[model samples]
Target: MSRKRLYLRAGLYAEGRSDYDFLLPLLNRLLSSLASSLFPGACDVEDSLGIDAPYPAPSERAERIAAAIADRRAECTLFVIHADGAGDPRYARQSCLDPGIDAARRASPDVVTVPCVPVRETEAWLLVDAEVFRPWLGSDAHSALPAEPEREADPKLTLGRLLKVKEGRMRRKPERLYRLFGEEVSLEALRALPAFQLFEAELVEAIRAVARSQGWPR
Candidate 1:
């Protein structure tokens, strides 16, 4: 008797507009686009929760999301999305799963977890960007820096140093995503990268699988 529902877990611990700069918009677009392509709008997509604040901890974030879903009192499919960082992605996922697991045991199984490629998984994207800025750095790309700068210097040197100096900055944040792509590139670019695309495609499949398992929409 309840309408079908879909839950999206987004990661927003980065610079730029939390949802757009991070993963929510992309995930929503992918799921909606895929659903329309496959089912031609036969099903409706509703969010169980919207992320409005910065969460200090993933477990707390997961708990808040779980509470929102319970308040809806609707049967739904869940998809959790997050970037792997210094914190354990597995722990973040397990934390999200705990509440859903309990909910499912008391009700029905409808939650699925998918972890995206770590910075290591997408190293080529970083290498590509580095090569673009390398020429301007010249020998300075590897040179040691003065303790402090007295005057303005080349911008490329600053970027080169960031790429070399910050061991994890380029790797961890969602903003780096734009660095890999040209503005002209369509959303398809993410789908082109097996490292990036597979995670999303598989996530959709997981949601579909859960929905089917719940006997939703026949």
Candidate 2:
């Protein structure tokens, strides 16, 4: 049997980091923003698969997730949920958040939940980081840049192609792209994207709310 893991100061949840590479850095950025006043100790995210299997039967899914979390209730203070906006982000993200919140509550009623679903997909937010894209574009960064990345229909495809331009034959696999963002890209550049804005605002507020509850200054 696995030893009982002592609880950390906090934690986060995402669908699959390998499948959605950008989300990890994005989540980390939020932690950086909140670390000083909100999460003083190390706070990290784990793929939800560790808690429950991917998309179990609808009837059993929530119960399974709740049970899993209850079994490991000591590992987190709250769980920030990461998902994609399959159709309409505002509406679609809730599909995951509602159930996730319920599941977390089963483990601890006070668990705070923050939901993020980049418009269309998280890749959509990356496209908006034109400062980083400029390096890839060489001379065409200004001209090749899309003015409305959020309006794009298939951002994942668009991002994959853009990444290839920087790397001749390499695909936008998780490690490669995540490395670029972590080591090369400028986080400030992404603030222009609406998806990032939403995430920033929601995360700031969530952290503030938690701070208030803990009687920490806002």
Question: What TM-scores do the predictions have?
Answer: 0.44, 0.72
Error in Å for residue 89 of model 1? 5.8
Candidate 1 lDDT over 1-218, as tens digits, reads 86555333322222124323435544555556666665563556553333322344235554544443444334345544443322343464465445443543354344454555333222222222323334334565334332222121332344334554344345434344433322222355345444456676766676566557556554
Residue-level lDDT for 120 in candidate 2: 78
Model 1 Cα RMSD, 1 decimal? 10.3
What is the Cα-based lDDT of residue 96 in candidate 1? 42
Per-residue lDDT tens digits of candidate 2, residues 164-211? 743365445556676466444456666777777777777777666655
Q: Which parts of model 1 are misplaced by more than 4 Å?
A: 1-21, 46-49, 52-65, 68-77, 86-108, 112-117, 120-185, 210-218
lDDT of 1 at 75: 38
The TM-score measured for candidate 2 stands at 0.72
Q: Which candidate number would show the highest lDDT if scored against the true structure?
A: 2
Model 2 residue 113 lDDT score: 61
Q: List the lowest-lDDT window of 10 residues for candidate 1.
A: 146-155
Compared with the true structure, all predictions reach lDDT values of 0.43, 0.59
